[model samples]
Target: MILPIVAYGAQILRAEAKDITPDYPDLKELLESMWETMYYSQGVGIAAPQVNKPIRIFLVDTAQVFERMDDEEKEEYDDDPGIKRVFINAHVQSLDGDEWAYNEGCLSIPKIREDVLRPEEITLSYVDENFEPHTETFSGLTARVIQHEYDHIDGKLFIDYLKPLRRKLLKAKLDDISKGKVSVDYKMTFPK
Candidate 1:
């Protein structure tokens, strides 16, 4: 099932998501639906809040990103082999290394992309889809994707990192998105 992504201005998108226990209703089913929705929407990552679910869950798949890179680029990012993972109740233990800028986008804020600066590496601890605990560090593009999704669960948007002037310039577009005035290929639930 492809869930309707909650668009910008949706109350849920601004609310901090709660952690879900292993027994959360239909956990398996919800994850599956999220993945389907993500792929259908051509998104590398999706968070529970994007689907109107206030739970700490997000998925990331970087295979497409890896595939698009040339041989030289792949060599530079050798450690990143298109990781695909589900993070539940995730917490960033630490972030290290110099900050780099990456163009980021979100399913909830469709058609909006901006250069957002973030740390080059991060140490994260989270439970997997099966509720198994894992702590790991990520870098490069993978880390960037994870950080973007992590923000969603924390009630943060990439645009929030932009300069005030840039945000102001995008005000009309943002308002259009909230009112379902923008065109998006994927289904979205705009604010009422």
Candidate 2:
């Protein structure tokens, strides 16, 4: 099922998500729905908050990004191979390396993209869909995607990183999104 993404100004998007236990109701089903929603929305990542669920869970699939890259660029990401994974109760243990700017967007904040600077690498600890614990490091575009989704679970948005003036410039557009005034291909639950 494709869940209606919670749009900007939804209180759920601003609230910190809670961790879910292994026995959480319909865990597998929810993950499946989230993946369907993400793919349907053409998003590389999606967090629980985006779907009006205040849980520390997010999904990432970089295959589409990989598919768009040329041979030379693909070589740098050979190890990733665009694997999809579920992250539950994730925490970024550390962020290292120089910060780089990337154009970032969110399914919740549809049609809005901005250059956001983030660390080049991240060390993250989280439980997988099956509740297995793992700690790993990620770099490049993968890391950037993870960081973006991670912010969602933490009640942060990419636009929050922008300069005050830049954000001010986008106020009207953001307001339009909140009020369901913007056009989006995917279904969204806008704030009242």
Best TM-score goes to which candidate? 1
**Model 2, span 1-192: residue lDDT tens:** 999999999999999999999999999999999999999999999999999899999999987888788889888653356757899999999999999898899999988899999998889999998899999998888888999999999999999999999999999999999999988889999998
Q: Give candidate 1 regions above 4 Å deviation.
A: 76-78
Cα RMSD (Å) between model 2 and the true structure? 1.3
What RMSD value applies to candidate 1?
Answer: 1.0
* Sequence-dependent TM-score of model 2: 0.96
Please state every model's RMSD to the true fold in angstroms: 1.0, 1.3
In order, candidate lDDTs are: 0.92, 0.92
Q: What's the true lDDT of residue 161 in model 1?
A: 98
Off by over 4 Å in 2: 75-80
Looking at model 1, the pairs that clash are none
Minimum summed lDDT over a 10-residue window in model 2 is located at 75-84
